[model samples]
Target: MGNILNSVILESILLDEGETLYKQNEASAYDLADDNGYAYHKVAAWVKGKDGTKYIKTASIASRAQLGKVNVSVTGKGAAGLYEIDSEFYTVGENVPDPESIRNNSYCYSEVNNVLVSNAIYRSGFANLDFRLSTGLPLKQYFNNDGELNEATIQKVKNSLKPLAKTAVSENPPIMREHLIYAESLSAFVDWMVDENGEMVNKVSNGVLVVDVGGGTTDISFINSANEIYMPGSDTVKTGVLDVFKKLKQYLSSAYEIDEEHIRVDMLDKALRTNKFTVRGESKDCEGLCNKAKQHVAKRLNNFIDELVTTTLDHIIFVGGGAEALREQLL
Candidate 1:
């Protein structure tokens, strides 16, 4: 039996509610389910296969158990017997077993014995192929650095994306190179938009400005009427959304003259839930502290935007995690 293992790294924030989220989640989860009928249909479409021939069987297995049961919904002839399966799942957490360790022979045979037994169907003496459609192995495993994804790493990831094929193996060349090119261009555009000095570049011929603000970096780029795009630079700053909480901590410490480490989680939770930073004790600086943090964030965003607009001639388009949150301040 041949088995294919496909994996995708999804951001938690992207899973927020609504139709877009549902569709994305479903698409990602569908790759792990057994779709023998679907595969046969595809074969039938492309070739003159025999009516009863069992050409291919596709199955999707998720690495995370918390995603819940796998629901196989079939239409046409296969719809009558669709069912669910409680498959074995695994994830790499703070202290969890490393996925690369298994493939690299770093893991002891005994350590993965349970995983092997539980996923025997996948481990059986057949072609065991690992598929990363969008990126290479986890970012941490691919890069030796400690920080998040960088421009160079993004480029590497774009280059590593596999093509859409029934089966993929390390030895096989990518089935579609265009997908890689598209992904690379998109990633490059994003990287150019967030780089601190990216605005210095002239412009692309398309005449569209791109701005990207991510957790670890911000990039700005401009495309001119001549269809030439240019990037001045990017900012690799530590001031992300998470920094807001850190700034809140510092603000509380200075205003209340209290040890931030001793602050209760409940208080922090309340602040986040209410969207209002509050202190229990009689501290007149509580409001001021909150304002200061907000001001700092606003200042950084303003500076980045000011530089980006001043250096470019194209209309602005913002994309990224931080950009979404700063929409109010941006206007």
Candidate 2:
């Protein structure tokens, strides 16, 4: 067993819908280093005159080509009565060109699988690697009914991922073995109670409520002093940071009469943070627009939080990407 262990590398991957995070066995246990997680995106551009052309390109951060493979497929209409070819790829730090493209059922599987294999291989020093991965599902997604993960649904997710894992692993020099993916939260409860060592931070006989604002959804639940995970019970709202971005996109599209694709994710963020932004050398201000959108989302969140009367609680916690954004408004 020792020899076998030495022969193959072990890796734990957090397969987030919005991001992919992983840590290798060589790293200290529970230590998430800076290089661990990555934003998920694939920027594939169609090559003109190419039909069904596909190739995976790898590169280091210092090198330009690390964006993975460029896949060319005959899709949509082309210029001047010719069938057009389309390709998509992604680079780190760049806003996703089309959020809907990745959110749908058809295009996402390949993107996730390719990135998983590419990232694993990159970490393994381009060697054939056997990976044991760990991932999380949204509390509401896996436990939609009765606040518990359904057995059949869990099995379905696992089974669907297995083949994707195999295909990704085999694509590069590193091949993956078996892997594991699971799902977390109660943000304040996570920090205040759960320690890095998986031990309790403090023992108390009090109830705590946790609210986590995420990218696509916000989850709410409760935990008692006895460490029993309870809820109002647990529930989720469909409002999140992405929703805000979508609304901003809509506003920009209507106001400027520009194609929605031209509005990058970063642009929305910039417009929100700084009231003014420029397009084609023209400066525009969107303070009123962004404020209205923020107010709309805040109202939804406020309504959800208002329904919480689940047992008297000693504390309440708010966390996740959307938490900070809504903090002042929520308070």
Candidate 3:
């Protein structure tokens, strides 16, 4: 139990709604810049008779750093239909474009757990160590129609993560000893208050609202005095950081005549925060489009908060990857 608690409390992996993976206090996950599905097919067609090694070295299609080790696979479609499948050695990116997509897929689950394992090993100072994972679900999924935690949903999530328990990779592999999950409201509250010494960082016993603005959804929770979490009034917003990326992707695609697949969510996300981004080997200014998207998201989220929260709240704290990005707008 102590080991499990240490793993759960010492580190955390946040699988944000945008399909972005994050490891706490260590390396933040990055996406594969290449579209891999379509872009690879287009690039593979032109490199048919050319030297494969030379093409990978000189091609401006994808940077070596972005794609990592490239793998080319060929498949027969039908009579006289030969198709090439170009992909990275490992998985990256959202694999699908839908903003409402669920994280039930293997790609999403593996990446998230892999980060957890990596962090656990680092914290333990051992190359191979067991870990207990702690994650959270949105408020809507926390309970069933009976107002009880839906065991079925929790078990389904555990089953989905079973494959990542003992992941075997080229580098130091981690063995997941156990896994646990709690309501995200609790997770948010714990993440904010707990410090490195496992002591409460803030003495705010007053009602505080925690707004976790993530990629696809914004989860709001209120922690009141006496360290109690009141979740009946908690809510989730459908629009988040990814919505901004989609809008920016559409704007850039139409403005520059670039393919929609060429724009990645991470790139546009960086641009929104940094005000500069790269597309098709060229750096571009995206401040205007990014600002427009940010302003719109802020307005929509503000409307939700105005309706839900009350004047009794002492502090409204923002957390999560997109929290900082949307902070200025919210304020």
Best by lDDT: 3
Best by TM-score: 2
Number of colliding residue pairs in each model: 37, 15, 0
Give TM per candidate.
Answer: 0.39, 0.61, 0.60
Residue-wise C-alpha lDDT for candidate 3, range 213-257, written one tens digit per residue: 765677787676877656665677776766666777887778778
Which residue window of length 10 is worst by lDDT in model 2? 77-86
Give me the displacement of residue 220 in model 1, in angstroms. Answer: 2.0
Worst 10-residue stretch by lDDT in candidate 1?
A: 37-46
Q: Which residue pairs collide, candidate 3?
A: none
Global lDDT of each candidate: 0.35, 0.49, 0.49
Q: lDDT order of candidates, best first? A: 3, 2, 1
The residue-by-residue lDDT of candidate 1 on 1-331, one tens digit each, is 0112322222111121221111123223211211111001010011112343322232222221112222222432221111112232332111121222222212212222222212322321121223211211222222234434445544543433222111111232223212111211234454544654445453444456555544333444455555444344323333443444457777777766778876543344335335555456542425455556656775786676676555534456665444654555553
Q: Which tens-of-lDDT digit does each residue in 1-331 have in candidate 2?
A: 2332232333222221222222334442221111111222111111112333333222222101123333222452211111111233332222333322222222212344334434443433323434443434456655656666655555654554444322121332333454343433643566687775678766546677677776566777767767766645567776776677788788888887888878877677678768776777898988877777777787888778778644666777887657766676664
Off by over 4 Å in 1: 1-132, 135-207, 226-228, 233-238, 256-258, 262-273, 277-291, 311-314
Give the distance in Å from residue 17's predicted Cα in candidate 2 to where it truly belongs: 29
- Candidate 3, residue 330: lDDT: 86
Cα distance off (Å), candidate 2, residue 256: 4.5
* Superior by TM-score: candidate 1 or candidate 2: 2
